[model samples]
Target chain A: MRVIQNEKLRTVLSYLIPFVLIPAVVIGGIAVFRSRGYSYLIFAVSALTILLFVCGFDRRKTGTRRLVLVAAFVALASAGRAAFSFIPGVNPVTAVTILAAVYLGGEAGFMIGAFSALVSNIFAGQGVWTPFQMFAWGMIGLFAGIFAKYFEGRKLRLCVYAFFCGIFYSLIMDVWTTLWTYDAFNLPFYLASITSAVPYTAVYAVSNAAFVWLMAKPFSEKLGRIKLKYGI
Target chain B: MTGFGSINPAAVFAYFLCVTVSGIFTLNPIISVISLAGALLLWAVLPVAKNKRTHIYPVLLTLFCAVGNPLFSHNGETVLLVINNNPITLQSTLYGLFIGIMLSAAVYWFSSFSLIVSSDKIIYTLGFISQKAALVLTMALRFVPLYIRKARQINGTQKALGLYKDETIITRFRGGVRVFSVLMTNMIEKTIITSDSMAARGYSGGKRSGYPLFKFTFKDAVFLAVTVFLTLLTAVPQAKGALDFNFYPHIDITFYGVSSVAAYTGYALLCLCPSVYEGSDRLKWHYLISRI
Candidate 1:
C-alpha cells in the first residue's frame, strides 16, 4: 500500500508541477518585461510557447491517439463556429464553445475553444475582442467542468443545460463589452442591455440548438473513449 | 502587427498604462483620436496580419456604436436636425462618435495587449502572490475550457438517451436545467479529484521556485530603456495641466505651437518606431520619400 501510494504521489507531482509552474513563469516574465519596457514580441512569443507546451504536455499525458480525437473535436467545433454566423440569430462560436465544453470536459473544451478562437482569429486578425472571446469561451469550459456532474450520461438535460450556458455566456460577454466600452452608471441600463445584449442572446440561442443537435453525441462518446483510453 | 515581433514587452505595457490613464481622466475626442491612431499603428505592425478578418468585426462594431448613439439618445447643443418634433443635435452625435471611437480604440488596444501578453505573463507578473493563490488563479483560468468540453460531451450523451424528445420550450428549458445540474455535479467531482492530486503532490508548502522558462536577456535591457524614455515623455506633461484640451464644435486647445508639435511628435514617434525599424530597406526608402 505504501509503495502504491508513493507511486501515485509521484504521478500526481509530475502533472501538478508543470500546471503550477507554467503560469508563474509566463506571468512573471511578462511583468518584468513590461516594467523594463521590453517589446510586445517577447510577450507574444512567451505566451505562444507556454500554450504550446501546455497542449503538448496534455497530449503526452493523455496519449497521442486521444489527443488526435480531441483535436478533431476542436476542428469540428471550429467549423460549427463558422457555420453559426450564417444562421440568423445564432452565434456559432458561443454554441460550439458551449458544446465543446459539454463534450470534452472543462479544460480540454476551454483550450479547444480558446485555441480555436486564437488560431482562427489569426486569419481574422487579433483585436481587443480576442481576449474577450477567449475568456468567454474559457468560462463556458469552466462552467462545463463545474456542471459536469449532473450531466453524467443524460442527453436531454445536457442539451437544456447547454442552451442555457450558451445564452448565459453570450449575455455575460455582451455585458462585459458594454461595461468596457460604455459608461455603465451614466447610461440607462435598459438601453445598453437592449442594444448590445439582446442581439447577441438571440443569435446565441439559435446557434446553441443547431450545434448541440449536430455534434454533441458522437463527440461526447469519442471524448469518453479517449478519456478512458488514457485513463484520465 | 509586424514590428511587435521585435518590440519589447515593456514598451507595450507602458503604452497600455498611458492609454488607461489617459482614458480615465480625459476621454475627449482628440485624445481618443491620438490614442486610436497609436493603437492602429501598433496593430498594423503586429503579426496579426495572419488573421485579418477578425479585424472587421470590431470595425463593424465601432460603426454600429457610432451610428447607434445618435439614433437613440438625442441630447446636446449643436442641433443637426429636427425629426418627429425632436431635435437632433450635432454635439450629441459627435459626442457619441467620440465615445464610440474611444471605446473602439480602447478595445483594439486591449486586444493588441492581450495578444502580446498571454496568461503566462499574467501569472508571472503577479508572482509575488503565494504559489497556492497563483495556482488557484491559474487553475481557474485553465479550468474554463476543460469544463466547457466536458459539459458538451455529457450533454451529447444525455440527448442520445432520449432525454431531449419533449419539444415544448418549457420542457426543453427544464431539460436544459437538468443537464446543467448534472454537469455541475460532475465538475465538483473533477475539481475534488484535481485538488486531491495537487495536495498529494505537496503543493501546501510556501513559495515554490519560479517558472523555469523566464529569463531576461540583453535585448530586454534595450527595450526597457526605450520604454522608459517614451513613458516619461508622455507622463510628465500629460500628468500636469500642460497637455489638457478638447475636440467639439471645433478643435480647441490651450497648448498650441511647440507644445502641440512635441505631443504630436512623441505620439508619431511611438507609432512609427516599429515601422521604421521593421520595414525593408526599399520600403524604408519609400517611407522616407513619402515623408519628404
Candidate 2:
C-alpha cells in the first residue's frame, strides 16, 4: 500500500503536497480556473492542510502513552459530538479540544479538533465543508492551547474563548459556503450568508460558553489528576 | 465489501477523483447533466443497502443551489424578473442550476464513495503517508463506541445512585455532561493501561508494518489505466480552455469541435465506468448461479 517508495521522495512530497502543490491548486484555481467552480479545489486544499498537520504529528517521536492519550482525546471529542448531535450547531467538541489542548499542548489540541471533525463526520455525513469544519475546530483548539495560561483557572475567560470559537466556526463555515456556491468570495453574498446564519451562530456561541462553563471544572480536575498519577 | 467495493480502493479513489474534478471543472450544462446522471446511476448500482431517506439531502442541496444563486447574482441580458429593484436574469438562474447540478453530482459521488470506501480502506490509504496517524485514527474509531457505551453506563449508575434529579431538559443535559466527565476519566485510565500493555509488547521498538489487506491486481491496473486515459482525454481539452463556458452578460459556448465532443465523451465514460462495472459484475454473478 506504499505509494511513494523512496524515503527521500516521500519526505519531499510530504512537505511539498501541503506547502507547494496545494497552495498552487488554490491560487491557480482562483486566478486561472475561476469560472470552473474552483471552490472544490479550495476544499481539497483545506483537507490537505489537515493531512499535513496529521503527518507532522506522525513524524514527531512521541511515547506510546502520549499517542494513546491523543487518540483518546479525539475519541472523547467525537463521542461528545455524537451525544449532542440532536442540537444544531452545538457540540462539546470545541470545549473538549480546548481542554485537551490546555493540558496536552497546541499540537495535540489541533489533532484532537481536526480528527474529531473527521471521525464524527463519518456518521454525521461528510461533504465539501468537512475540511473547513476541521480547520475551524482545529484552529480553535490551537489558539486555546497557545493561550492556555490565560484560560487556566479563569472559567470566565474559557467561556469567552469558547464563545469566540463558536463565532469563528460559523464564520469560517460561511466563508466556505460563499466560496462553494458563488465560486468567489462575493462580499454581498457572504454577508447575506452571515445574516441568514445569525440564529445558528448565536446558538452556537451561547452553547459553547455553556458547555465550557459546565465541563471546565470536571475536565481540568480529571486531567490534572491523571497527569499527576500516571505521569502522562 | 462486494461488487464495486471489491475493486482496489486506490483505483476507486482515483476514479472518483477524476470524475469529480473533471465533472465540476468542465462547467458545461450538457456535461453536468451527464455527470449527474452518471452519479445517480452509480448510486443505484452499488450493492450496499439503499436508504430512501438518504436521497433527501442531495435533492434539497440541488434545490438550494438552484434557487439561491439567482437571488445573489444579477448577471445576463435576459432579465427573468425584478424583485426589490433587482433583476433576476435568466443567465444567473441557469448558471445557478448548473452549479446545483454540479454540486449535487459531487455530493452523490462522495456519498457512494463513503459507502464503498469504509474506515479500514481509509486507514489503508492513509497508512501510506503516516502510519501513526492511521494508528491514531484506528484507535480513536475504536474508542468512540466504547466511550459512548461507557457514558451510558455512567449515566445509569448516576441515576441509580440518585445523584441528580433528571426532570427537566437542563437536568438531562447536566446529567449527560456528568456522564461524559466520568467517561473521560475512564477513557484516560483505560488508555494508560492499554499503552502500558502495548509498551510491554515492544510496540514502536522496531520498524512497523501493516497487514497487506489489498493487492493491486491486473484487473485493478486495467481499470486504473482506463480511468487515467479517459481523464487525460478530457483534461487536455479542459487545459486548453476549449470547454470554456460563460454565464455572465451573455450565455455563450463557443467550441463544439471534435475535440470538445471527445472531451465530453471521455468525461461521460469516466463517470459511467463504476456503475457499468457494478452492473456487469452483478449480471455475471447471476449467470454463474443460474448455470450452477
Candidate 3:
C-alpha cells in the first residue's frame, strides 16, 4: 500500500476528483452526448462517488484499532440488516451508521455505511440499486458525522435525523430508478415513483427512529468506554 | 470455477458490467427483447439454484413497470383508454413494457454476476483501487459470520440460564436486542485485541501486497477483446442514433441501415457469448471423455 507521499498532491487530487472531475462527467455527458443513452453515465458517477469516498477513507492514516472498529461496525450494521430481513423496509443499518459516525467520526461512518450496503447486498443480491444504496447510506453517515456536535446527548434530534435519513435514502433510490427507467429525470415519472414508494418510506423512517430511540444510549456508552480505554 | 467462471475476475466483471449496462440503457424493444432472452438463456445454462419462486420477483417487477408507466405518463397519440379524463396512450404502455424488459434483463444479468463473481473476486476488484478499503471489506466480511455465530451462542447461553424467553413477539424482540447489545460490547472489546495482534503481526508494517489468486491469461484477454469489440459495435452506431427510439409523442424506431444491422448483430452475439461458450466447452469435454 503506497501512501501518497506528497500532501499537496493528495489534497488536490481528492478535491479535484469529486468536485471537478465527477461533475464534468455528468455535465459533459448530458451536453456533448445529447442523451443517446447516459444511464451508464449515472451508474459510473454513482460508482465513482463510492470509490471516491472509499479512497478518502483509505488516505487517512488511521490507527489499527480504529480500522478494526470500523470493520466491526460494518459487520454489526450488516448483521442488523440481515437480522431484520423478515420485515420489509425495517433495518437498523441507518441507526448503527449514525451511531458510528457520532462516535468514530465521519470517515469511519461513511466506510461502515457504504460497506454495510455492499457486504449485505453480496448476500441479499446486488443490482443497479446497489451503488445508489451505497451512495445514499454513505452520505447519511457522512452528514451525521459532519453534524455530530448537534447530535451529542440529544437523542430526540438523533431520532429526527434517523427518520429523515430513511426518507433521504428512499428518495435517493427513487432518483436512480427514475434515471435508469427513463434515461432522464422525467418529473411525472419521478413523482409517480415516489408516490408508489411512500408506504416503504414511512415504514423505514419510523423504524429508523425507533431503532435509534432504543439503541443510541447503549451504543454511545459502549463506544465511549472503548474510546477512552483504547484511545481509539 | 471452470469454463466461464474460471476467467479472471476483472475481465468477468467487465463483461457483466458492459452487457448489463447496455441491456439496461437501451430503449429499443428489439434490443430489450434480445437482452432479456440472452439473460434468461445464460441463466438457464448456468448451474444456479432455482425453486418454484425463482421467477416471481422479476415477473412482478416487469408487470409493475409495464402497468405503472402509462398510469403516470399520458403521452403518445394512440389512446388506449380514458381514466378520469386522462388518456392512457398505447405508446406509454409500450414504453413501459420495453423499460420493464430492460430492467428485468439487467436483473438477470446481475443474478448471474453474483453467481460468477464471488466476494473474493469483488475484494480483488476493489483491491485495485484502495487496498485498505479491500482489507476493511475483507475483515468486515469475516466478522459478519463470526458475529452471527457469537450472537447465536449468546442467545443459547441466555436460554440455558433461563434468562431468555420467546413466547411472544415482544419477548423475542427484547431477547434479540439484549443479545445484540451484548454482542456489541463483546465485539468492541475483541476489536482492540484483534488490532493489537494484527499490529504485532505487521499487518500494516510496510507496503503490503495482496496474494494473487487469479492470473490474467490468454482466455481473459480474448474474452475482454470480444466484449469490447461487441460493445463498440453496439455503442458506436447507438451514439450515431442508429438505435434511437421514441415512444412519447409517437412510437418511432430507427431504420436498420448497414451499420445498424451490424450493431444489432453484434449485440445479439455479445449477449449469446456466455451461453455459447459454456455450451461449446461442455461439448468439447464430452468428446474428450468419450475418446478416453
Candidate 4:
C-alpha cells in the first residue's frame, strides 16, 4: 500500500506538535507535581533536548565539518555572554545575539540566542526568569535576523549597525525584566528601567563595536564562500 | 539502540495526567519532597551518562528566586532582619525559599521525564493529532538550526561582495534590516515550495496510518499499572483535604497523620523503582555492545 506523504505536510506537523506538546506536557506535569519549581525545570530540560536534537539533524546535512562549526558557533555565542558580564561596561550577549540575527535569520537567530541563554543560565542558575531571559535574548536574535537584510557588508556599516543593535537589545530586555518582576505604571518600573539602562546600554554599545570590528569582515567572507560551495 | 530499558509512553502519559490533576489543587510540600527525592534517586541509579555540573544551574536559579522574592514583596509575620528600616520577616523569606525549592524540584522532575521519554514515544502517544499538524510541529523543531545555518551563509555571501558596510549607526541599522528582509523572503519562498510539495503528495486528503517501531507488551501494562497507582497515591493528599499550603509564618507541614506521610513516601519510592530496573537492563545492553 502506498502511503501519502508530503514533505511540507510532515514539516508543518513536526513544528506544530513539539510547540504545543512541549508546553502542554510541561504544564500537565507541573499540575501533577503541584510544584512550579519542578515544572520550570522540566520546561528547560525539554527545550534543551529539542534544540539539541534539531541541531543533530542539521549535523547530518553537511557532516562533521559543519557540525563542528555549528557547535563552535553555539559555544562562542554562549560563552560570549559570560565573558561580557565580566567586562567593565561590555554586554557580549546583545552583540552576539544581534550578530546571530543579522547573519542567521529569525529562526536560527532565535534558537541560538535562546539556547545560549538557557545553557549559560545553567551556571547562572535556572528560575522563573529563565524563560523570560530566553524569550528576551531570542527576540534580539530574531530582530537582528529581520534587520540584517538591509545592510551591505562593509566595516563602517557593520560597526554602526552593531552599536544600535546593542542599544535596542538592552532597552528591550530591561523593559521585559521590569515588567516581569515589577508592577506596571509605577515608580519601581521607572527606577528599574532607568537604572538598568545605564550599565546595560553602555556595555552593549562597547561590546557591539568590539565584535563588529573584530569579526564582521572575515566571518562574512568565510560564510559567503561556504554558501557558494554548497550552492544552498 | 536496542535493549535499552523501555519506557511505556502510555505510563508516561498517565503519570503526567496524575501530576496535572493533583498539582492544580495543591502544592503539597511532602509530595514535592517525595517526588524530588524519587527523581534524584532515579537519576543516580539510571544508566544514562551523568553530568554533575549541569545540576548547578537549577540550584542557582532556585536560590536567586528565593532571595529575590523579598526584594519585590514585603508581607507575612515572624520578622527576622530589619533591612533599610524595612522588616525582612523570617516567615516571608522561609516561605519564599520553600516555594522556590518546590518550583525547582518540579522543574527538575519534568526535565528528568523528558530525558526518560523519547520524542518518538511522544509522537506515538499523540498519534490522534492530525498528521499534517504533527509533521509541521516536528519540522519546525527540526528547522531551527537549519534556518540559522542558511542565514549565516547568506550573510557571509553579502559581506564577500563588499555589499555590507559598517559605518554610521543608521547605515548599520539599515544594513541589518536589509539582511533580515532577504532572509525572511527566502524562508517564505522555501515554505511555499515545501507546501506545494506536500499538496502534490495528497497530504491533506484523509486519515493516515501511523507506523510505530515498538508494540505494546506485557511490561507496558505492568508499568502503566504501577504509574497509575502512584499517581493515585500522589493525589490522595489533595483529595482528602489534608494537603496544606502556607505562604507565611514559616513554612510548616501538618499532615493528616504519620500514615499519610509514610504512604506518600512509599508511593514515591514505588514510582522510582522501575527506573532502576530499566536502567540496569540498559547497562547490560551497553556492556554487551562494548564486548561485541
- In order, the B-chain TM-scores come to 0.74, 0.94, 0.94, 0.77
- Please write out the lDDT profile of model 1 over residues A1-232, one tens digit for every residue: 0111244554564455457656664554334223112322233333444344343433343432333333434444443343333345543455455555665566666665665565445434565456556656666665765577776566666667667876776666555544444434235533566566676676566547654664456446645653565454
For model 1, how does the per-residue alpha-carbon lDDT over B77-103 read when each residue is reduced to its tens digit?
567778897777676567567777776
Predicted structure 3: lDDT: 0.83
Per-residue lDDT of candidate 2, residues A1-232 (tens digit): 3444567887886787667877776665544344645676766677777877877886788889889999999989888888887667778888899888998888888888988988998877776567788888888888888888988888999999989888988888888877767777889889998999999999889988988999899888988888898887
Please provide TM-scores computed only on chain A for all of the candidate models, following their numbering: 0.63, 0.88, 0.86, 0.64
Candidate 4 per-residue C-alpha lDDT over B44-80 given as tens digits, one digit per residue, 9 for 90 to 100: 6655676777578658856875786665556767776
List TM-score per model, in order: 0.56, 0.94, 0.92, 0.55
Model 2: per-residue Cα lDDT at residue B113: 81
Which scores better on DockQ, 2 or 3?
A: 2
Least accurate 10 contiguous residues by lDDT in model 3 chain B = B46-55
- What is residue B23's positional error in candidate 4, in angstroms? 6.4
On lDDT, the leading prediction is 3
lDDT tens string, model 2, B1-292?
Answer: 6677888887887888778877765577888899999999998888888788878877887788778888888878998889999998889889888888888888888889888888888777777777788888899999989888888888788989999667876786677788888888788888989999999998989855446578889999999999999988887776667677887889988876988888888988998898888998889999999999
Residue A129 lDDT (model 4):
51
iRMS of each prediction in angstroms? 13.6, 2.6, 3.4, 11.5
What are the RMSDs of all candidates, in order?
Answer: 11.7, 2.3, 3.2, 10.4
A87-171, model 4: which lDDT tens digit per residue?
4555455555665456656655665666566556544444445556676677666666776766537667767877876776666
